[model samples]
Target: MHARPEAWILSIGNELLVGRIVNTNASWLARRLTFMGFNVSRIITIPDSIDDIVLEVRRGLGKVRVIITTGGLGPTHDDVTLEGIAKALNKNLILNSEAYEMIKEFYNRRNMPLTRERIKMAYMPEGARALRNPIGSAPGCIIEVDSTIIVSLPGVPREMEAIFEEEVKSILEIIAPKISIVECSLKTRGIPESSIAPFLEHIAKSHSNVYVKSHPLGFELDKPILELRLLVSATSEDTAKGIARSIMEDIIREVLKLGGSTSSEYCV
Candidate 1:
């Protein structure tokens, strides 16, 4: 396995487009992938249209090494993800035998009708790898387009989470082969991006390999909080941990001196 350049997450669903859904899938998966040491380039939300889906997939292929798409893999008319992905890659949509049988068994177990529409969940693009979904009927697929690995998962958060854990996570672990890519995150209270920009600029310039990102989640007890991400690249877990720890200590001291109190030295 070789190194992963990065991942571009494209979350689909008309609900997400019209603001019916908040797109928690992309945010959740992005943070998970980043913490696992695979870089996430961008998170985009698009409507359930073939032209738009293919366009975004084609565009993301050029910029990122991987693409993970969520939504539209259900048994409804709007469940057009399979069709769009096939159209994008000029691939054929065929029913996966295993997935078909799995869905059949599910309906049989429930004593429900084996309708053709319900079986639609088993269809996938030709030459694509199916990602098993133990929790739902919609089986996901991982395909390669222009040398980019594109993962299509169900829209349901629990189902998406299961397929990714079963399919994508292990693949990334194999590709990266980290003896230990240790990371440390610091959660600080009452600090805005403006106040930390200059300090982060210096830190970033000094440590090019160490990545830092701030996520503002309104803090506990009515105080605003920012989570500082400190990622280090090293061959060993201990070495990576040491590098992250050192960088974290420096940032904590600097932020404290700047009148921003830290809620944690290491956030998990």
Candidate 2:
């Protein structure tokens, strides 16, 4: 049996693309998903443009099992993620009364008038399931279409993190099979990248399920250290972690066997 490749993150907002905002949402989502043992296969950023969003959605749907999008989901003219998702799936945005009432209450609580524009935040792609925004005005949505699960969350990091943690987490746990990609690393001193290439390659071929890479720091500054990472992708966290742990143990054993000093981190 084999594990399915799962979960891609899509970030939406013109601010992100134009560099007005650094995309903390993607990293936050990835870290959370990784902790939950979901394979964070890919992460991409796009503008608020519908065409761009739809294109990325279609492309991601083909490759990843679950698609989680953040940003462009608010009660404003520029918030077009809902329509983009609907178009990508060939659906329409329809008014969701539950969401409508929620949005209404949001305004009422703040002592603000519910303008027709703000109330429109209740509209969702037809057949989309609403994921309540416990902290924000816009309700996120989860739609199951063509075997792919799409979850949309607010772009604001706090709100996005909240909804993902509170709402989408349990739902995905129910629908998604257990899977994980785990990795552990070793920091080697007195070793250069060129010197470790063959060893890295040897380890990689021996474990087809694992990947190895070396990163060098401070090469131009006359002092450089090499980092070797052993990445393992498996169907479950235990399997992935087990493999990673085994490899790390083997590397430690080898270094100790050779009377060479190794460290968990490179020191200055």
Candidate 3:
């Protein structure tokens, strides 16, 4: 069996750690990576500290095929993501002419003077490819270290998304797993997650490729509500969908047997 390429999303920013902002970038990247046929192994949010970024980057190297980091790519002092990544790989932070030109163009169009702080966005790890940001000034970067590819993107959601869609998506396609993923989600009532734990386990053991998980939504003592999600991957779309449908039917049958009601079934 062909193993799916594993990935990690490293979100950097003090605001995320302090709960000042939600980590939407991580979720967006996770969904995108999953759809691209990569298994997202971890989503980590850390402060805008160079030491912390270094630790995480070092940890992700050699462990996962891809590591995508969002945030700390701004012109501010706290934007040390690239610096940390450079230190982790023992590579020098050099002035990338392409990135500098992109940033210069952004400022030149608005008649804004290029300050040292603004030019800071042009420096990236040596041998990194600069990805243009269509909606923002900061240019993202892609660095290949042996078998691991690290992508550093701006913290801004729109800019990150633009760079991913226009630039990074094609690069990832070359390495993305050639598999089809089918997912099913169902809402159940009248039974708690504990009641269906055994059934889910049995299904998981029977079908190793399917991922089964339950999210409890309501109070167990009063009205039990759960969101059951199943994901399966196969070599083709028809096979994946067949497996997912079969698993969904089995789960529904088990839920009805346990005196539970299911609704809101959807596939994605």
Candidate 4:
């Protein structure tokens, strides 16, 4: 979409739905996907129910270029992400040889047997390739259906990050659009967000390629501090940064005209 590949992050876990744990996986994946030139359009959280997973996974398939799912991939009965994905794609869950070996080796080193629960991590949807997890028992997986790629990672933060870095990054790089994004955050004080709402909207409308948003850091009734983030995507890093810098300068000038003070402008 918009000349950039689109992606979605689907986080599945009962704990997440119940607020027992934070959904940091979605935010981490979102940042990675955006930095890789994919427009992360949605970050969805669903319960670890097979029906819910099937619904969301099927919704993402063929609609976005990439879909990344995290969580519910452990050895417990509640860990049924793969099963739900298989059902979503109308495929059978089969023991993946590569994944099985990875799991077996992980247990062998620990002098542990391949119990039924442990072996459960080896099953995946048909035709999916197992990604080696450098930090945990469960190996991740990637599968392509039509033009869409679906990647599933373990819920553990360290395990998910490791697999994505070691295995999934290469695959995504192959399909990611040749685009660069530059993001800059500027801090503004002595002006409330409401006072700058119109200006922000005008800036966004003026630059169709640039994304503008404001994060308020203080109460609106008082002299509020606002963190303004400007993001622009271009074919090269220099071009993207230049556009973002120009936009930031314009915003800063406008804020100064409105009796606001600006500081701490940095790009990433």
lDDT of each: 0.81, 0.79, 0.93, 0.91
Off by over 4 Å in 2: 35-37, 179-181, 219-221, 233-242, 253-261, 265-268
Ranking by lDDT: 3, 4, 1, 2
| lDDT tens per residue, model 2, 1-268 | 1254478999998888789888888988886776565678889888888999899899977567789999888878999999999999999889988788888888899999988788777888899988878898998888888778899999988888888888898887776556566767777655566766776777888887777788885453453466777767677678887778877777666545544446783211
Compared to the true structure, candidate 4 yields what TM-score? 0.97
Best model per lDDT: 3
Instruction: Encode model 4's per-residue lDDT on 201-222: one tens digit a residue.
Output: 9988888778899999885457
Better candidate number, 2 or 4, judged by TM-score = 4
Q: Candidate 3: where are CA atoms >4 Å away?
A: 219-221
**Model 3 lDDT per residue over 65-88, tens place:** 999999999999999999999999
Off by over 4 Å in 1: 1-4, 177-181, 187-196, 213-227
lDDT of model 1, residue 77: 86
Clash-forming residue pairs, model 3: none
Q: Which of 1 and 2 is the better model by lDDT? A: 1
Clashes of each: 0, 1, 0, 0
Angstrom error of the Cα, residue 60, model 4: value is 1.5
Q: Give candidate 3's TM-score.
A: 0.96
